[model samples]
Target: MSFINKMLPNVSLIWPDVWQATLETLYMTIVSAIIAGILGLALGVWLVVTDQNGITPHPVTYNILDKLVNIFRSIPFVILLTVIYPLTKAIVGTSIGNTAALVPLVVGTIPFYARQVQTALVQVDPGVIEAAQAMGASNVDIIFRVYLREGLPDLIRVSVLTLISLIGLTAMAGAVGAGGLGNLAVSIGYQRYQSDVTIVAMLIILVMVFLVQGIGDWLTRRTTHV
Candidate 1:
């Protein structure tokens, strides 16, 4: 407290609120990421495997999914938040709290991350896939044991980008009463003109962002043998 107060004299009054807000931010990110990761991975793999020249090659399904991904990707997240308010409320019983915010956050991230995942899967070597096929591997087996396994390093990189992106969006969602560090920063800090609080919140967010990036980079390096 002494050190923090020395650096930012008002830290004493808001430290407790800052800590609570940090937890809310963590809660929002973790829950949102988990939901997005699962749904995005499935949609992404399906998009890749069902394309005209892909492993399963169903042109119709691929085209439909491709269009949907494109459409969702086009909608800016701030607009999407309000646009989906009814459904978000129905699902989460509110449209402005952290949990309600998850609906839009997850929906907003899914298509983007799906595209990232698809791109990563598409980077798998053609020869490796051909060899897998030559060994009579089924499409499911190829998807799991080949594309996902071989492209993991790239996938990790994309996941890091998505997670960082979500952190920013969470800050924006704070405007709608989605309580988090973002809410603390914008509502209490900025709106209330407490520059010190805003600075502290931003610094905390920066540290979190750096940690996520460093871990992702480390994991990518560890997973890559070449």
Candidate 2:
């Protein structure tokens, strides 16, 4: 207690709020990452499968999905939160809490991650895909067994990048009343001139980002086949 007070004088005063805010940020990051991962993976796969040279080529579908991804990825996340406020409110029944923030977070992350997934998938050897096709493997088999399996390491790498970006986004979300460290730092710490509080929140976020990067690197190394 004494040491903590010495180390985080202002933060110790509001330890409970800091703890709660940390939990909220984690909640937003994990939940949004999951939903975005699944959706992004599916979207990325569709983009690949519909490409003119893909196993099930459909240029029209590919172009549409491609353009949509580009459009979404072009929007800045902070503006996205406001642009999608009505949708967020509709989905979560309010547009200014942790849960509501998930909508924008997921939406903002999906396009970026989808592109990463696409890049990772496209790196799989075309010859390998061809051999799989020759063996009577269905598109599903090629996607899951070949593309996803072979790209796992790269996927993990990009996912780490995406997740780190998402953590920053969570802070931005917090700035807009989403209830996280960003909110703690911005609303109270910075605004109230509590530099110690701001520093504590920033340090916690940095630790989390580095931890994610370390874990991601370990997973990538373990999964890499070549």
Q: Which regions in candidate 1 have their CA more than 4 angstroms from the true location?
A: 1-3
Count of backbone collisions in candidate 2: 0
> Model 2 segments beyond 4 Å from truth?
none
Q: Give the top-scoring candidate (lDDT).
A: 2
Please list the C-alpha lDDT of all candidates, in the order they appear. Answer: 0.91, 0.94
Residue 17: error of model 1 in Å? 0.6
RMSD score of candidate 2 (Å): 1.0
All predictions: root-mean-square deviation over Cα? 1.1, 1.0
lDDT of 1 at 82: 89
Query: Model 1, 1-226: lDDT tens per residue?
Result: 5797777876577778889988988889999999999999999999999977689899899999999999999999889998999999899888878889999999999999999999999989979999999999998899999999999999999999999999988888876699998898888788888889898989989998999999999999999968
Residue 1 Cα positional deviation in candidate 2, in Å, after optimal superposition: 3.7
Q: Which residue pairs of candidate 1 clash?
A: none
Residue-by-residue lDDT tens digits, candidate 2, 59-159: 88899899999999999999999999999989989998999999999999999999999988888999999999999999999999999999899899999
lDDT of predicted model 1: 0.91
